[model samples]
Target chain A: MNFYDGLTFPAAGVIPFEHHRAHTPLYYGIQFNTSGTLRVRINRGREHTLTGPVCFITHPGAFFEYSLAPGERHDFTFFCFAGPRVQEYLRSGLLDLTPMPAAISREHKFVETLRELLRQRELGNYPESVNLLESLLIQLRRQTQISAFLYQTPRLQELVHELRAHPERDWDFEKEAGRLSISTQHFRRIFRRHTGNSPQHYLIQLRLAQAANRLAHSEKPIGMIAAEVGFEDVFYFSHLFRKYYGIPPKKYREEFFV
Target chain B: MNFYDGLTFPAAGVIPFEHHRAHTPLYYGIQFNTSGTLRVRINRGREHTLTGPVCFITHPGAFFEYSLAPGERHDFTFFCFAGPRVQEYLRSGLLDLTPMPAAISREHKFVETLRELLRQRELGNYPESVNLLESLLIQLRRQTQISAFLYQTPRLQELVHELRAHPERDWDFEKEAGRLSISTQHFRRIFRRHTGNSPQHYLIQLRLAQAANRLAHSEKPIGMIAAEVGFEDVFYFSHLFRKYYGIPPKKYREEFFV
Candidate 1:
């Protein structure tokens, strides 16, 4: 009943200063760069630079070469998993093979999960390792969808990051537009196109998310938490929290906080 | 590159008062009883009463019927995972398709992980659900190996539970043997056979594990923690802790404590 009951894990580890060329690999490969830059060329194509947190996939018989700068050492995790179902996933488009720029944040779960997978594999916990790999794949696939849109404009990505970093800030659309050297209407359109939410709605959602997290993790009073996340009115915060989470803040904390 | 990429999750959920008979199940099935008793008859064999926390696996074409008492309601989680690798695991002995009495404790991770898996599935997070299932399988397998030995004698099982619950208790092997109405030598042999350690050594391990956990989670001083785990001599505690964990308690707390 396990997901990887019969799959073969040939090799999985965190490699430093890895430089290799695979003419015809026997298994599917997933690799994520943890630090420094990696240049990867696939099937005699132009080389692509991978910096920061990034991941790529290579299937069997895919000619690829990856290397780092001279005398440069960087850490990266590589996983090789092979099974009949792998081909089926590729055919069904559930698993994308293209290289993806992961979330450009250091706190992204990709590297952490991969490291944990390697640790579990080293400890001979095959089932746990396989489960971590499955979770990592799902995270990578979801990141690809979001990152592809967010990375389209550096300015928008910066603004999104700022909003996430400080959701309590009283962010104004006009000020953000002026900072980006664009009209308010243009800013709203582009931001919506990239993030699927208008600026004000996005900020509200971020604040609510932070509030929910605090409610579940901290014993702070509901009014204090509301004000901390930029909601001045506790009643309105309760209404929004209930509308979004289908439960009042007090009940949410009671149910979720351990 | 992900496990369960091409596998089919036909159904996974928690059901109350479940009663079912399958002449030939089309998919691999895993079920865990959360509460009440479940009587399962596999392949027309003698019915087995499963009380407390227990899990069982059923494969395709396995004739089985499971039910509860009339008008009696019990909570259970069921999962159906179908793939070609299921047969391979069965053949290789990695997947044991048998009823296993899980840890006789309500705090086991089996139910929690299954509930989380169901939640993820309902939220349309297929990869997370699959990962949780894999992790749950690993946990169940590990528990099976340990529980089989512990359940051999109810008296010894009870003793082990007591030791785990109160590792700091000042235990004496002779007293335990006297309570069990057995000779000291016989008690040592049976305890070693059942737990793979002498009672004294097992108690020491339990105490050391508790100390390690406290070191990682609490800000309590090392000497106080040592005393709390029944170690009156801090130096001896540090020595044993170092021998078992490969690091001094201070360094362990420094490295692991967040």
Candidate 2:
């Protein structure tokens, strides 16, 4: 279906080159340097020197440009997906397709995951390939947004971990901000910057994600699940679920029920 | 590169079908009867009705035939491998390819493992897919030998589990046989029949498998790993390891060091 394709970096010798595509689909590339350097140019952005592991994503219809210094070398694997869901994911900010590339240290798990997606394609297992590709997008989203500043803010990280682990907790932004010794406004601003969502919105997404998981994997009643994820009113929960997921909770469960 | 291929069962009304080829690859199929029955015939063997979850293996160059009753429905998934390692695995008795189809009760974990393999294939993730497939073979080996009589024999089951969990223990056949109120010769015979290996041989394989896993995953010294898996003589351990795996422990570690 041309949904995705992948491979380990080839062993060809490096030569200076440029690739430009005017109307490319969503492009995802992960490159790592054992040693040496790689330079990348995205849309009219300046040539960025990438050392260690680098991840770059380009939105649909965006121009992509690439180059390598003469005799310089790097290893990379890539996947490109073009479909309606890709556009929806981009619009919803579940996938970041900003032209800027981000560099991080080599993440073994991330590389292994990409290779797994490639392996699935080799086996002609298309359905599973797309499933893992969406998950890879989730991982890449987290990686791109995580910065050194976020690491310095341990309290915010702790708060996020707590919220995800115990979504049923009745969270209050003011109280949480007070516990972190930050004003509620400052807390919301920084949380949004790091996670691309305000604290309240992130919490709602977390609660809905958990509820969806439980519905698909467990036989819990809809009302019980609503209550379990901190919903006081089942109708309100259902309404919010429909708003975010398009389909209501019951239909979503039936669609993904193992 | 055609090491393996897999598929979930297709939904279709049944008719008499015969599948024959001059030289077929090794075949493994796990079918679950979510609704109806499936009947299979292997190389002139009497028709076998598989009503529940059933697993069957076919050796290379074997004639295989299958059918389902009219108006009946069934679900099945299968894998086939054509590689040198598969031949070695079959010779070592790690994968049983006896012609008779064996009907087994639904094993939730087994079904989940195959689904995981299918997921890996769908992702075009060949390396991880093969890795999971080998582990699946190991699982099927255990399941195939576990007869109803063995299930009724809790003591025997416990013994096998203990040996697997703690291969480092110094086990003597006579002593364990006495514990189970059986003669040493009888114990050896039943254990061989149930596990496709004598107790001593089975323990050796279990210890070696553990050692291989540790070598690939941990930085422990060869001598330490040998002793940890109940080998007082490292030299003897290395010899057996080379004989079984066609490489010394150190070489095997280097080959699979990740």
Candidate 3:
């Protein structure tokens, strides 16, 4: 079935005190809890609490229900897919997902991914949207530890994961390879093959990504942020950041945080 | 800057053979040709031809150039995002995307996702649109082997993938759960907990979804489609299809396919 025929992306927002009653089997939903606490139930199932930075999946015809905890205002974003596949998945027990992205970092990633998905959809990139929905499912599963591996050398993947987890780490090719029990020469070759970039280049990119995230989302000082991302010389960091990002770090942060 | 601040979902359609000459940096573009062929160039870069079901990203400030391939009628969808993030990503080589989703299936998914994005935007779901755009980038990166995964138990995710990919499969719980090295009883329990439905119910939904898609997209006979989607009894399929879709199979086809 063409996935588009029955698909729907309802405006995402808050639902007040009253809960949504059970409806017919029609749409599948991914709901992210953005604020406060959301309490949900499927049919006569036990109540589940959805804290901030968490998400849950709902199948069609599941007698679904949701509401904010008493005295709390609820905020959420939902992406709904309608059609037989959703129903089928629901019936097969594949549509049952709950409270995803248990960690703060992963939750942030999930929210960012959803934001991009919405952007593409708004631009009329239908095919890209479908791919993104698939992407989102995979991301959720990765958090669940279901083995969603990037097609890279295991050692390189491990290094990249670490870099993402802790961008402040002083990472070098020799050090990374040693930690992975591999030779530096082999590591460089495989890393380039998988990432299409030299190890140093990849590390720089990771650090910049971290910096960008921080500059946009936090009130940290630019020099402090540079140091946090492992730039010993704030001047060099600003120069490289300007050269690569098309603007000085201070300007970039001003454009976003201001 | 907010990604949405300078974004524009240009009306999706076509641009004539008159080439778009490069000018001062303004918008970033992700264009998909749904039909015919389009030829484009960045600055004096090599000519790139975009055929049906093809996509390309053009950065700002590269003296962008494009035209229809000789003797071809070009129809396309263009998603233009402006502002500093686009420029920054471009300079950093993060936005140098070209002819993405080379595979037909993936290309189709990308288009569908974009359509939904547009729908949300038209409804003034600005926040949702932003989220979806972020999602699309993640999806594209995942496809590039940067990573993508599905959230759910492996066995269940696989089954759902199969149903989505080939809904006509003669799916049954006993057979499917067995294929996953599990017992029917355990499978049923788990499936309900996850999906809130029995396995048999899910397969029926898949068949119906397939039928709906075929009815909307093809000129096939209702009976043929019913059988094709695993309904041995045409009358029964028609009845069930009508109950779910609020229209008879023949009428539904006429309303959509015609």
lDDT of 1 by residue, A64-147 (tens): 777776566677667877766566567655477775345436346566677777777654455677677767767776677556
On the 0 to 100 scale, the lDDT of residue A108 in model 2 is 77
Q: How well does each candidate superpose onto the true structure, as a TM-score? A: 0.43, 0.36, 0.31
Better of 1 and 2 by lDDT: 1
Could you say which candidate leads in TM-score?
1
Error of 1 at A16 (Å): 1.9
Name the candidate that leads on DockQ.
Answer: 1
The TM-score-based order of candidates, best leading, equals 1, 2, 3
DockQ of prediction 1: 0.11
Worst 10 residues of 1 chain B by lDDT: B1-10
All models: lDDT?
0.70, 0.61, 0.59
Q: Write one digit per residue (lDDT tens) for candidate 2, span B127-239.
A: 44655566566556556556633754558878887887898999987999899888888888777656556898878877887787788678999999999999999999999
Looking at chain B only, the TM-scores across the models are 0.55, 0.55, 0.43
| Candidate 3 CAPRI grade | incorrect
Rank order by DockQ, top first? Answer: 1, 3, 2
For model 1, the superposed segments whose C-alpha errors exceed 4 Å read A1-6, A19-26, A69-73, A83-85, A99-108, A123-129, A148-258, B1-100, B104-112, B115-119, B149-258
Q: Is the docking of candidate 1 incorrect, acceptable, medium or high quality?
A: incorrect
RMSD of each: 18.2, 20.2, 19.4
lDDT of 3 by residue, A1-258 (tens): 122334434222233443444443344566676667666777767887657666767655567677766566655666666554444444533334544333223666578778877776554344456556655764554444322223334455666666657767877779778876778897787666444357787677667757866896789898889999989999999888775666788776664342
Q: What share of the true interface contacts does each candidate keep?
A: 0.25, 0.00, 0.00
Question: Please, what are the lDDT tens digits per residue for candidate 1 over residues B1-258?
Answer: 243454545455566665654445656767787767778887888888877667877676678788876566677777777766565556654467774345435346567777878777654355677677667766766667557645544587788778878889888879988898889998888776555468888788778868877886799999999999999999999999886665689986764453
